[model samples]
Each structure stands twice: as structure tokens, then as C-alpha cells.
Target: MTETAIAEHGLIGDLQTSALVGTDGSIDWYCCPRFDSPSVFGALLDEHRGGRFRVCPTGTAYTTRQMYYPDSAVLITRFHAEQGVGEVVDFMPPAGEIATGRHRLVRMLRCVRGRMSFGIEVAPRFDYGRRAHTTDVTESGAVFSAGQLALTLHTVREPEDERLARVRVEDGDMRAGLDLVAGQVRGMILESGADGPPREVRVADFQRLFDETVRYWRSWLARCTYLGRWRQVVARSAITLKLMTYAPTGGLVAAPTMALPEQVGGERNWDYRYTWVRDASFSVYALLALGFSGEAERFGVWLGDRIRERAGGAGGPLNIMYRVDGSTDLKEEILDHWSGYRGSRPVRLGNGAAAQLQLDIYGEALDSVFVGDRAGLEIPYRGWLAIREVLDWLAERWDQPEEGIWETRGGRRPFTYGRLMSWVALDRGIRLAMAHGRPAPLERWTRERDAIYEQVMRQGWNEDRQAFVQHYHTEVLDAALLRMPTVGFVAPRDPRWLSTLDAMDAELVTDSLVYRYNPEASPDGLRGQEGTFSLCTFAYISALARAGRLEHARQVFEKMLTYANHVGLYSEEIALTGEQIGNFPQAFTHLSLIDAALTLDDALDGPTGPATGR
Candidate 1:
């Protein structure tokens, strides 16, 4: 099996889709044209059946290290072998802002020290290995074709070396090996949707593309306004978020890979290559905090379109998630043939949670707009009307029991976090109307917001436990409640919030790694347990900082950073043994990292810093 550790990979993208390049010199996960498309290389989930494109130094006795090229998404994996030192640079050219079906991935290899032998394996099982493909080996490179999908591989060398240029196709796959001296280089370009065989290429062309890609990323990062204590980590998270963003639709995928189990051998694996309203809304705050106003504005426009369309059912104005293109055609299905990551069975595609009635999304939606508006993101008059209509509808049914933020399939409940966010929706709606002088039902919205606040205070709290429970029914603590102070639903120093924080600290915080909720105490209609959620841990850090626990927050923050993989990336969750075990390089984790960094920076800067309010 392609059993690379999840944390040993770095990410690179063209703003439309991305690939996970493991430090072992294998691109184990990738999707073409778009993030949600069927994988062309998915060895991350299955070994023999799922395909992979691997370029590594010959022999297994070499130490490998991976890192991003400074502030850019270009990933470099270096090999330290007894014979010599070599490195592979991997990157995707930015696809710009338009939607297209073409993409290019470039891999450049250089022998930095003495002569070293390298091997190339191109095994692409298209359609997730369901479809057979034909590979044609050529004198220069190779072409792999399967039905409508076609991939052309181009190879070029720095100097004419006939001995290192021969490649062959074996068992429907492409394979080659090269032995290069120091200062020699090899370039391989894999292009998707190739109309014809690639023409002759030169090493100079590859160098030009490499330089241009580096400049593209460095230029984009220049707009970051964060100059605080954790600038490097904050910047890394920002770049990760940018890499996950689909530029054409301004929608950020939750993460790039799917069916990577939260718990090893558990059945909780799910696809995350779609946009969640709740996650993107939080991303709005993080982006604006980093002074990436352009990104926040684009997402505001994308969300406004969702609001105007109103394509959801009883869950208010928007679906909990959608495709990067804003389409609601996600049909959850199982790939019964392909094995899941580490044998976590029943690998799934698409997401059934798209139709879930997560009422908290309304608040997250409006909160994003509100955050963006504060940064000069203006809503058109028609968009404002849609927001008003959504609020009016939510006003009547804000108290209805529905799925919470976790999308638990155990059935709906009047989740405290859902109600908290519903209150946020109305409260922000009222603020926006007053600030912009827009027409809105102020009386009804105010009444409903107050009612939600009062109801949560009364029914959602456990007087015996002296903490706010997950919902009104149980006394169990949830990390989601830690968001109360950040959204202004409750003051940071409020006694009730402090008690809830203390309760969470006692129950949910294990060495600063936070769990969303206890599955044993509160079953989620799923089999087996999950890891400590990375997003929840970062959110916990933010909450801790806001609650004036700066020392504890800093310690937890540093410890959490240690959990990040080799190249400073985090997955959806961390195993009890500290291995990342979910979707690799999740956007929610990075967004919360940015949020936590900003909050902690402000808290540590004392009273002379920017306002800590969201």
C-alpha cells in the first residue's frame, strides 16, 4: 500500500486544485481540473489499485526532508543519500481567476552533490482505478490516456545525456531511471487534458516557469499585514488557505484529500473537497485579520450569491456546504472497490452533509458578511434584500431543533451552538441595517435575537454543572461553545462563559488537544472514535487567549504547533499518538491557526494593541 504518513506531505496548488507530495518523493493524492474531480493519482487511499506518480532517489536507505520554498507553495523534498545529495522541486502554476480545464504540474530534480541515481514511476489509475488506461511510450516522454481524460508527460534534461534519457512503459505504466552528476538537472512536466503529444521542451523553459511561479506566490504574500510574534506560522497558514481556495468561485475546499480516517481503521472517513458555509465564514474573519481584503471580498461575493439564490430547505438561506463552483449537485456515494486510508473501510465520495439542516450556518453566513463589510466589503442592494428575507424566515424558526455544527447524523436537537449562531445572525443583521441605513424588520429581529439569548441562558445552561452544555438535554461539554466570546454572543470575562470554559478545560482539553465532544457521552450516530480535532484545538487557543489565560494559551499554542507535520501543515485531526490522521492540510485548521495567532498576538501586546474583538 502507499502507506506514507499523512504528516509527511507538503501541499501545492494552482488555486483551483492541489496535490499532496509526501517527503518520500511520492505524490500520493491529486485531482485534476478541479478539487472535487475524480482522482488521477490517489495512492493515498489504496496501494495497488489507486495510482501514484513517484520520483525519488534510487534505493531505500536515504533520509528525506520536505519544506515549502520560503513563503510560496512550491514544495521541495531533499534526499540525503550516501552517494550524493539530491532534491525535487514540485509546484503548480497559478491558474489565474478564470475557470478552465487545463492544469500543469512541474517536477524539477537536481543533483546537488555527488552523482546520484533517481527513478521515476508514473502509474495513473484514472476514474479512481475503475477505468483501464493505455500508456504509449515515446522516445522523449510518454502519454497516458483513459476515455476522455488524457495526460502527457514531458521530460527534458539540462545537458544531452543519452544514458539517462531512456524511458519505458511497463504493465500499462511508465518507468524511468537517471543517474546524474552534480550540477545536472532533470525536468518533468505532467499536463492534464493534453490535446496532443507535448513538443520538445528545454531546461530553460522549465526554469522560466519556476521563477514565474515563485514570483506569483511572493507577490500575493506581500499583502499580508501581520507582523506579530508568530508571523512565520501565521504566514504558512495563510499560504495553505490560499492554496486550498478555488479562484474561479472564491470557494475554499475544506481540505484536498478525502476518506483519510479521523481514527485509524474507523469508518468516520468523509470527503472534504467541498466548501462549508460555517468553515468559510470563519475563514472570512481570519482572512480579514491578515489584511487579505481581496480574498475576503471575493468570498463575500460568493456567499452573497448563495444567499440570493436561497437554494436550501428549512436550514435558512444556504446549504451547509457546496461544490467550489457553488453547485448543489453533490451526491454522496461509496467507492466500494478502492480501500480506504490505512484500511478504514467504505471509502466515500461527495458529502451527504450537504443537505443537513445545520441552522448555525445562517449565523456563520451573516457573520462573514458582517466581518467583510467592516473591511469595506459592500453588499449590493439585491443581496441586502436576500439577507433580510433570510433573517425574517430565521426569526420565526430560530428555536427549531436541527443538526448542530458537527453535522451529527444521530438526528436534530436544539444545539446550544446552533442557537448561539442564530442569535449572531439576527444581531449582525440588525447591526448591518443600522450601520448602512438599509431596510430591515428591526423590531422582529431584535425581539428574536433577545429571545434566543434568553433561551440559551435559561435552557442551554446546566446549573448543576455550572457550565453551558452541548445542547439543552445533556450536561456534556463541547468545544464549539468556546466560540461564544469570540463572536460577542457572550463577553470573554462573563461568569457563565468562564464556568463553561473551565468545564471544557476539565473535560475536553487533554494536554491542550481539544475534542469536539465525547462520543461515548454523546453518540454521533457513527461507529468508532475520532482524533483530537485540530480546528478545535486552535479554536481552544483563541478562546483561551480571549479569556485572559495568556500563559496557558501560549503554552498550548506552542504544543499544538509541535503536532504540525514536517512542513508546518496540519490535517483535520491528530491521533492520540500525535500522528495526523484525517484529511491532510485542512483549511479549517489553518484558518483557526490564523485566528488563534491574531488573538494571542493582541492579548500579549497588552492594551496598546488592536481591539481583540472579532
Candidate 2:
């Protein structure tokens, strides 16, 4: 089985798409055109068949370290050898308000001490390595062409005053050998397109791009109002969230790469390149907390469009997820041509849960709308009517069994988290009506919301466990319920919530890490043992802080920080060995991290312990 430590990587993006750069100086995973597009470099999943681009020291043994540039998405990977130190700076120039088909990955290399010899390799595997590509090499660089898809690599040397490097094409891959002395710099730009002709770029051009990318990031982060103790970490999370967002439509993907295993050698690998309603809604809250009201408002508009598009359709209120452009057709397929990550079989391409009746989305969607409205984003009259209709429709159907928050294929059960979110939807909707003086079925919403609360308190609670269970029929306690306080469903210090936290701490937590639930107690229709969920871990910290357990919360938060990759990026899960697992650079994890940091910071600063926003 081919394997690389999942945590040994950093992320760079242009808002529309992202790439994963391994610590060994290889672009292991990159999807062209867009986040959900076909992979141009899929070596992260199948090392043998999927292609990669590597630039690293070829003549010296070295130790590697990587970090992001302060608050920016730019990543720097340093190689330390006995005789010299070298670094590669990786970043994609941020695409402004305009949408375009061009996407570029820039790599700048320099030797800071002594001397170092470096090697470069560029291999392209189009359409997930199912098609063969032809490479044409010239004095400028090389272009790999497969049908309509083409990737051009442009190389630039310092100047005539410096020693020049030699590049050769071998075995359908571009190879380059260069020796750099101290303060010497070299660069390469990989551009993907259908129309752009291959050409050589000047060092001055690359210098301008680098400077502009840096300026863009610094200016963007300057808008942040978080002057808290955890500012650096919180800012990093914000930048990650921004990186994972689809700039054109303001849709936020759960993560950039897919088919990464939740469990090594397990069949739980999934595609998370699509936008999830639950994740995007929580992201809005995190962005708002960081004083990015424009992002929250734009996302609110996208979400409202989705709701309006599905209203009165046969598809029911809304699907759980959608394509970045709000399309609902996501056909899941297994790629039998490639070996999965770490030999985790059955690599999947698209999400099958898009059509699942995950009713919790309505609650999350309404909550986002409520948050946006509070942040002064106006809701159109038509938008309000569409939201009102969904709430009324939900009142009649919230009691039914459907796919829960986890989207488990085992079977639909009345998940308590689903019920809690349903109540949230109605509650938020009613509040919005009152706050905006909009026409709504206020009495019906209130009655349904109250009924949901009473039913949950009565049936969802497991008397034996002394906590809210995962579903009506199961004794399994889910860490997802950690959001109860944040959503205003229950007081953080309420006995019921405290009991739930205690139960989870005993059952689901391992050294401050949190498992979503015990699949042994409740099978999720997949055969695999998984890692502690990163998002759930953050939720646990937030809940603990809100409950006045500041010391416990602070300690857990600090430990969780250690789990982040060298560049402050987090994946979907963290293994028992403290390695990251599943789809990398997860937006859900980063957003939750922001929420947890903000909640904990407020608690630490205030005279009273964390206020639960009730």
C-alpha cells in the first residue's frame, strides 16, 4: 500500500480551487478549473497511477519543516541539510471579484544558506489517471495535453547574471537540475487551461505575482476584528475557510480533496468536495464572529437561492448538499481504476447523500438566515415567504423518521440532533418574523417548536445514560449534540446538557478528542473503525467553555491545537496516533475551530463565564 502521513502537508488555493503540497515538496493533489473538477494530480490517493509534481533537493539528505505566512494562505516548506537550508514558497494568486477559467499554481524556490542542488518533476494524469496525456517540451517549458484539457508549466530562471539551470524531458515528465547558492531564487508556474498557449515567463513577472498575492492576503486579513488571545490561530482558520470557499458563488466546500480515508484501510472513504448546508451555515456563524459580514451575507444569498429553487418542488424542502453552483445532482460512483489512499478500497467520486432526507438542514439554513439578518443583511419579501413555506412544511414532517445528521445508510431513525435542529429552524424563523415584522404563521411555528422541545426532553433523553441519545431508539450518545448551547436550544449549564457532556466525556472522548458516536453501538452501514472527529472536538471545547469549565476548555483547546498540521491545517478526523485523516484541510473543522476559539476567548475575558447567547 502506498502511504504518506496525512498530516505531512500544507494547503494553498485561489478561492475557486485548492492544492495539497506534501512536506517532501510534491504537489500531490490538485483539481483543475474548480474544487469539484476532475483531478489533474491525484497522487495523494493512488501514488502509482495518479500523477504528481515534485521539486526538492536531489543530492542531499534533509529534514523538512512547513508553515503558512503569518495570516496568509501562502505556504513555505523548508529543507534543512548538513551544508545548507532551502525553502519553497507555494501559493495561488487570489482571484478577485471576477470569475475566469485560468488557474495557476506558483512555486518559488530559494537557498538561504550554503549551497543546494534541487530536482524538478512534473507529471499530469488527467481525468483521475484514466486517460493518457501527451507532453511537448520546448525551451520555455512543457505542456501536457489530454484532449481538451491542457496544463502548461512555465519556468523562469533568475537572470543572465546568475548561473543558469538545465531542464530535460524524460519518460513523459519534465526534469530539471539546478544548483543554487545563498540568496539565489528560481520559480515555476503551472497553469491549467484549454486556450492558453505555452510560453516562458520572466522572473520579474513572478516577483509581481508573489508581491500581489502577499498584499491581497494581508489586506484581506486586516478586516478581521478579532483582537483576542488566540488571534493568530483564529486568523489562520479564517484564511482556511476563505480558501475552501468557491469565490464565484460564495459556496463553501467541506474540504478540497476527496477519497481520503476516515480509517486507514477502511471502506469509509468519501468525497467531500461539495458544499454541505450544515457546514456552510456554521461557517457563516464563524465568519460573522470574525467580523466578515460580507462573506456571511453572500453565503446567505446563495443559501436562500437554494431554498427558493427547491420550494414547491417534488424534491422536498432541500437536499443535504449541492454542487458549488447550487446544482442538486450528485451521482456517486466508485473509481475502480485506482488504488485508494493507504489501500483503503473503493475510492468514491461523488456524494450519495445529496438526496437524503436530512431534515436538520432546514434548521441550519434558517439559523444562517437569522444570523445574516441580525448582521444587517436584508431578506427579500420573496425570500421570507419561501422560508416561511419551508417552516410550515417542516411542521407537518419533522416527526417523521429520515436520514439523520450523520447521513447513516444503516436506516433512518429519529435522530435527536435532527430534532434539535428542526426546533432551531422553527424557533429562528419565528424570531425573524417578530424581529422584522414579517408575515408568518407565528402561532403554528411556536407550537411546533415547543412541541419539539417537550418531545426531545421526554423521549430523546436516555434515563440510563442520563443524556440525550443519538436517536429515539438508541442509547448511543452523540458528540454532535455539543452544539445545544450555542444554538440556544438549552442553557449550557443546564443539568441535562451537563449530563450529556459528562456522558460524552466518558464514552466518546479520548484525551480531549471526540468521536462522533460509537459505530459499534450504532452501525452507520459502513464497515470500518474511524478516528475522532475534528469538528466534534471543537464543539466539545466550545460547549465546555460555555458551561464555565474554562480550565478544562482551555486545556482541551490547546491540545487540539497540537493536532493541527505543521501549517495550521486540519482534516476531517484525527487518528489515535494524533495523525490527521480523511479529506484534508477541512473547512468544517476550521470553522468550528474559529467558533471554539471565539467562545473560549470571550469566556476568558468576561467577568462572568461564557455567555451562551441565550
Candidate 3:
């Protein structure tokens, strides 16, 4: 397989799970059944050991390009060779309301202008390439089986044609080739965990599924309420967020691919296939802003369950993150046998940061539920009581310090952002109780909230630097503090905030890209360094816009959009070289983009009204 750049890929998924298909015509990274499940194809991390399903034109020198079927998750990768032009359309049918332990990935090949020969390979590496698998190739397709995982690949063509008849098995993998002329087509459908004979799909069946899938995506996107500027980009981000959601439980994973490095040949790699409270809570606000109340309401129920499970128990109100099914057994493990992306070693599965103490989550959780409630998602009495219990639990322990939002392994300090969130948690909880006339302890919560405000103003501020430091001990600026204005903790144009923004502009912001924090000044117990955070950059744009710097904000936002990949997708971070790194199609980045776009649009319209009367 040709080496593919991380930015040269498009994403496709059912509501349950997603796959990353490269411009090179390879399904390089995919997890079966669920986003957190083991990989059926993972060549993005290790090209040799990590298996992949590749279908590309062979014996031809070609340049490739990729794009989404407009307003849909269906991805098309087009190949242009000396003799002809061909393309592959990839998609996964929507799982809809029912939750299942099975999934299907379809790839259709077409020669639009001339003749081209295509080669196909199916290699399955179960359990992160730690387990072996056996393959059976028949005339029609192939079946691959491991201990508990089975995948069947079906061929689709005209009954009278011989498009996929050249099947051969080699070294536990399946390989085949086919030739097609202009106006001819062939298809492949790979389904997970099927019983009895493999399901045979003809050309007509492929066309039916394709039409249904396209309709499903277009119909779903029609519900978006964002009619402001950047409509196309906002719609794409919304679709990406929906694709990351596990429809069964209404849980959203942070990203589909894991262990993509923050820095090439660096150890700053971690898994992001679990839901973080901070990420999901912010997602609720983004979804609600776009009129996606159903998603917000469902996430509210999922979050309410977490609170109820721990309302009367020990530990904090919630873990920093959780698995898709609301299970907390995310024990981190390292794949020592496989080489990491670009040799960034110790490719890890499961996030160890889930067990850390991050006080900011309370603020995020309460803020989400509060937003959902305001959007007409009613909080049942029992759920309200559980939320009250969580506030009560949080009120007692808001003072202490743990790892901050960055989840650094460095020892904890008095993180100012954490304190800001602690204040938000109490303030929102008190407002919820008062607005709905629910029973609660408002006096104690209000007192604590006021005290937290005082404490942050005093200790979190550094008089000499004229900026709020990352923590009490150091005079370092952090991009995470850009949310101070967005969360209502401080005014965007307040003298202090403007000064802090100026400080960050001098230190953290580079050509409009913002770094999370300077690790050189505040060593984060981790080796090497990282790139500018895409989420932080978007937040910076929001802060700029809210501060009445509309022209500058528009400039920064436009520049940031240029960093997005060809299909308007972003990874977690952007390398200094201007390429996307870290996990692909990150929810945090997309959500923040949506927020920034809305904020900028509102700012550009001024006090009269929105430009589109939205």
C-alpha cells in the first residue's frame, strides 16, 4: 500500500461506528461493532502489522482526491491516472433506532472515463493485531474468523458478469482483482458477525442501499437550525458530530481513530475513543444551538444515569470519561508489538486519564444539563434530585486541586480554570433550582460559589504578569482560559480579560494558531512536545469575537478554516508544519468550530439583528 498522509482521508459511518478511508483507496482505520471495539482494519497506526482493507487501481500511476457526497457522510475518493479516471464510493448504512452487534461497510468501484484495473485486499487483525485470524475465500467473496469476531465480505455485480471472480487466499488474507470499462461498476460489502451463509448482494441491492443511505443523511441534516454564515462548514461539522454518536446509548466518542501522534516520533500519543465529560457537555451546547434537541435530550438521559449511579456512592460526582455503553472499565493497555504512527511508540488503547481527578467536569456537566433544560428537555424529579446530590457532593470538595483540563501527568497545582468551573457548577445548579422551583440548598451553594469567585480573582491572578496564570505556582498563560468569557465567568471585554488576552496573544498565539500551554515553562511530566490545539484556536476565535474584535476574529477564523482538511474535518491538533495531527475528526475541535462560527456570525451582524434574520 502507498503511504498515506493523515490529512488525506475522509470519514464515513453509521450512527454506531465510523471508518477512515484514505485517498489512496484504503480503509485504513476501522473498529468493528462499536467505536471502542477492537480494530478490523488499523493500518493508520502500523502499516505492516495493523491490518487494512484496500481497493485501489493497480499497475497505474495515479493522483487521488477525496470529498463527501455533499451534505452526507458518504465519501468518494477519485483516482486520476494517465489512461482513465476511476473512483470509489464508501458508506455504512445507518443503524437507526435499533442497537446491534453487527455492521456493514460498502465500497463501490466505478470507471467513469476509461478502462482501469483494481486490486482488493482484505486483512483482519483482531484485538489490535494481538490475535490471529483465519480466512476462507470463495468465488463470490470471503469470510474471516477469529476467536469471537467474524467478518464476511460480499461481492456485488451483475449476475452475468465476472467482475469479482479472481479470488485467492494467501497467508490468512484474501486478495482479488477486477477490470472495468467506462459505465461499468462493481461493489464490495464487508459485514461483521453474520451467521449461516454470507448475504449475497447484487448490483440492484447495492443501488437500493446507496439511495437509502444518502436519503437518511440528507433528511437528518435538514433538521439543523444554523442558517448563518459558514453554512456548509457548520453542516459538515454537525454531521461529523452525529456520526461520532453511538445511537443506542446517545454517547459520543471523542474520535474514531486512536494513537495518532501529537508529534511525530513522540510519546504524546493517547487513545480518544471514549466520551469525556468536558467534551460531551460542550457538545450538548453546540448541538442545542443548531436545533439538535433530540441529541441533547438523549445525552441528558445518558448523563443523568451516570449521576444517579454515583449520587449515593463514594468518589466524585463523575469520572473524567466513560465508555460508550456507560461502563467505566477503561483500563489502559499498550500494544508493544505494533509500531506506532510514524514510529510514535507505545500505541495505547483505553485512556488512563479516565481515573484522574478533574474538578472541571462538574461545571461542564451542570452547564450541559442546564442548557438542555432551557431548550425544553425536562429534567425529571428523580434526575433533578440526583443532580442536587451531585452539587451537594461537589460543594464540599471544590477547593482542592487535581489534574486540570489538559490532563497533564505533571503534579497538580491550584489550576485557575478548575476553580472557574467549580464556580460555574454551583452557580448553574443554584439557577436550576431557583428557575424550576425545585427543592435544594441554595444558601450553601451560593456561598461557596461566591467564595470560589473571590479565590480565583485573588490567587489565579498574577499582578506582575497582568494575566491569570495557568495555575497558582507559575506565571504561564493557557489557551483553555479563553472560555472564561464564554462560560460567563468573566466579561469578554473586561479590562482584566483583555489584558489576559493580550498576554496570550504575545505568548500562546502564533499566526492565529493557539497552543494549549507552554510545556517548556510548565513541564507536563511528559516527554517531547505537542502542536497547537485546534479546539483552543476555535475558542480563541470566540473570545476575540465576543470581545468586539470582529474584524480580527473573522481573519483568525478564516485562517483556521484553511487548516482543516480537504473535507472540512480536523484532528485534535495542527502541526507547526500546518498538517493535522492527533486523533482524526475530533469532536472537541468540530464542536468548538460550530461555537466559534455562531459567535462570529452574531458579532458580525451587530446589535440590529442577524444577517439572515436567524
Candidate 4:
């Protein structure tokens, strides 16, 4: 079988974990129980060894089209054949405020018109396809068991006379053949670790689950206050971000899948299933802007707990990233058993960069708290103290650097973006303290904040390059610095920032798609090149809009939208040929898309000139 394009997938989740369903009617990637758990179906990364659950027309020439239900995460894939048209509805029942051991994937099929014949295939590979599993088939369903992990597939077909032999396991995998006329419905449920025998699924039961799932998503989206030009696209981006979040701890993973390479057949693949402070912190304002204050509030609480945990220990202020449960240790490892996506080898898990000291996180963490406060979420006094201690520690250590925001293995330098965010940390901290009448070392924070600003302006800027460079000594421009205006580090219309933007356009922008930095110009320890970053492109659009280039920003934003997948989903990066090249459905990219839309809407609605920076 040919490999599926990374962009040709839609996401569906229960707010705890998500699965990627391809346009060809296959659940190729899914992690059971939790977002970071080992995959039960991993065909997205490896076609042969990694298993898959697929439902499609059999022994016929069919054209496939996939789309999400309006305003919901329910995915529908339609197959048009000479005989008839068949549709498959895929979703996971919403698990609201409750965590369960059992996770179910419900796939319902219907012959919308004429007569259609469809086939079902189920293959389960446990422990990343390293463990072998035994399949057992019964009258009503089939079970694939490997150690403690077991997946049961239950099916029901109409006419009430279809024999069990039609839906039995064949050659170690569940195989089903169904023939249906117009208005006939067939249902299948694949569930993880149930207590008793698989229940007999009925059409009515499938309808109830589908309705409830739709209701859960539509109700959640009803809270959005954005009545803007890009309402539908913005809502889709918001839903994608929400799907990437782990609901239990309020921590959002960068993406659900691991080791989907930025550069195919390169060593750049790293696990993005862990939560990064930088990504989540940048997401707060976007969440709040869409009236999702509850998500922002939960993230603030989760970040506060991490702050308290770090402050109580002898370790530094914070790790760059953590597991969804707020655990600090994420030891990176490679799974050598299964081949990577398109031969992108050394599929990695557990990011090693978690232990690196990226100083910008303090600024991002404090900014998240500030944004949450603005959204009417309050922090406890102890949480405030924890934040205060982080600022105090930062005041002393901001000048030093370990690793930059990109988590480049190429040693650390005094990154200008890192310093810019440090200024943001103290700046926001001082404002929050005075605004709330909270106890903080305001005088010292003020001095440190001003000092850092002066230091960055003096050393970080390069007169020759006519821009704020990537690091203190290099003349390379970084797309990450595009946030300088959005974060209030520099005025949007400041001549210096304008010069920086122009410089970036010359070096980093390729027809409005932005690369993080040119690795050849400023070598980060990595060996291969990467695609243009989606998050950075959105940031570029936001910066352009805030700078009062409304028409140009609008053009860029619309062009970037065309780059999004068929379902309005974005991955971490886009290859030169416009293929999505990194982890699919990245939270950072979607959140930045929301921020860009909000910024552009505000710009288009407001006065013509750039506003003064704070």
C-alpha cells in the first residue's frame, strides 16, 4: 500500500487522547488510555508492521472524500462507486470531567444511496508493534489480546439475517463484508479493555453515541465569542487545539504522534507528545480570545503547580517541557523495531530537551498567568508566591543561556528571543503586582526589567544586519522574534522592529511562509534542513497585521489558509512541495492560527496606523 499523506488526515478525540483518521477510511494512529501512551494502531508512521483499522469499499473503484461534521469533531468519509455511495462516520464518545480506563472508537457506516458493499479490516499491534498478539473471533465480535492490553471489535449489520461468518476474523485480523441497500446502517465499535463480553451493538445505540458526541462539541463551540470574518476556520483551529489538550491535567501536548519527521529520512524527528511550557504559554491569549476561559484557567492552575514543584526543589526554575501529569522527567528513547514514516528513521519517544534550561519559559509562564488574570481567573496567594520566586530567580539568571526555544542540540548561547521573553516576565510580573495589590519585589523587578531591556537593545541588535539578530553575536534573523510586537517587547511600528521585519522578509520569508532560521547561516548542531514552520508563519501574519499592514497581512493569512489540510488542520511544518512534514495537528500551529485571525480582525476593524506599544 502507498503511504498516506500527512495532511490527508482529520483528528477525533475524547479530550484526553486523539486519533488520526486518514481520508482513505483508516484509523492509522491512535494512543490508548492517554495521549502519551503507546499506540494501538500505528500505521500512520509505518505501513506494514504498524497496525491499522480500516473500513472502505471492497473490490470496487471508488473515489473518497473526507470532511468533519459542521461545528463538530465527528468525521465523515464518503466513498462514491458505480454501484452506490457509502459513508463512514467516525468519533469517540466525549469523556467529560471523568477519566476512564476504557476508550472506544465508534465507526458507523451507511449506504446513503443505491446498493453498496463495504469491507472492514482490524489489525492490532501492541508495544509499538514489538509485542505479538493473539486474535480470538466469536459470533458477535473479535478480540486481539497482547498481555494486559486487549482490543475488542463488535459489529452489527441490518436485515437481522446476516450470518456471523460475514464478520469474523480472517488470517489473524478481523475481516467483515457487508452488503447494504439505501437507508441501511451498519455499526462497529473497537473498545479497549472492557470487563465482560462485547455487547451486541445496535443502530439505535450508535445513533445515541453519535448524537452525544456531536452535542458535546457543538456545546463547547457555542462558548466562542468570535464573530469575525474567518469564523468557520477559526472555530476549526480552536477545536484542533482543544483536541490536542490533555483534559485531566489541563496540559496540552504539542502533538499526539511522535517522530513524524520534519525532514524525511533525517534525525530531526523528536517526540512532540510531551507538553512544552513555551507552546502552552503562547496559547493562553488565543484560548481566552475565543472565550475559552476555562481552558486558560485550567492551564494556569497546571502551570502554577509546576512552578510550586520547581520552587520547592533545588532544581532550577523550570524544565522546558513535561509530561501531561506535570512530571519533569521525559527521557528520550528511540523505537528501532518499526520503520519510521517514509523511512524517517529512529522513531523517537520522550523528548530529551525536557531537561534543557530554556530561560524564555519564565516569561511565557508569567505571561500565561497575566492573560489568565485578565480573563478573570485568579491565582491563589501561594501560587502568586511561587511565581514571584520564579521572577526573583530569573532576575539573577536571565543573562545566562543553556538551550534556545527551538530546543536545538547545538549548545546554548545568549538568545535574543530568550532575553526578550525574560523582559516580558518581569514586565508582566510588575504590572500584575501593582494591579492586584499583591506582595512582590516591585523595585528590584523594575530595575532588572529595565536592565535586561537595555542589555538586549545594546548587544542583541546588529547595525550591519539592521535587525534584532537571533542571538547576541549572530547576524541571523529568527522568525521566533516576530512575537516581539505581540508580546509588547517592542512597538509594532518601531523603526527598529520594522527594520527587523524587513530583514526577516529578505532572509526568512519565502512567499509568506516563514522558516525558523537558516541552519547553514547559523549552524545549530543538527545535520539536516527543515521545512518552513507553520507556527512561525502564523506569527509572521500576526506581526504583519499588528504593524498596520492590514491588506498585506490579509493576503498572507488567506494564502496560508490555503496551505492547511482539507479539514483545516495544520502540522508543525510544511515541506517545499506543500506536504505537512512534522507532527500532525500541532497545537502550537492551530493556536497561532487563532492568534493571527484575531490580530488581523482587530487590525481590519480598527484605525489605519500601528498602535503604540505597551
lDDT of 3: 0.89
**Whole-model lDDT per candidate:** 0.88, 0.88, 0.89, 0.87
* C-alpha lDDT (0 to 100) for residue 456 of candidate 2: 95
Q: So what's the TM-score on candidate 1?
A: 0.98
Error of 2 at 534 (Å): 1.2
Better of 2 and 3 by lDDT: 3
Tell me the tens digit of each residue's lDDT in model 2 across 308-386: 8888666686889998988977899999988999898889999998889988898899888888888888999889989
Which regions of candidate 3 deviate over 4 angstroms?
A: 1-3, 163-165, 608-614
What tens-digit string does per-residue lDDT give for candidate 4 at 527-548?
8999999999999998998888
> TM-score for each prediction?
0.98, 0.97, 0.98, 0.98
| Model 1 poorest ten-residue lDDT run | 157-166
Among the numbered candidates, top lDDT falls to 3
Which pairs clash inside model 1? Answer: none
lDDT score at residue 551, model 1, on the 0-100 scale: 89
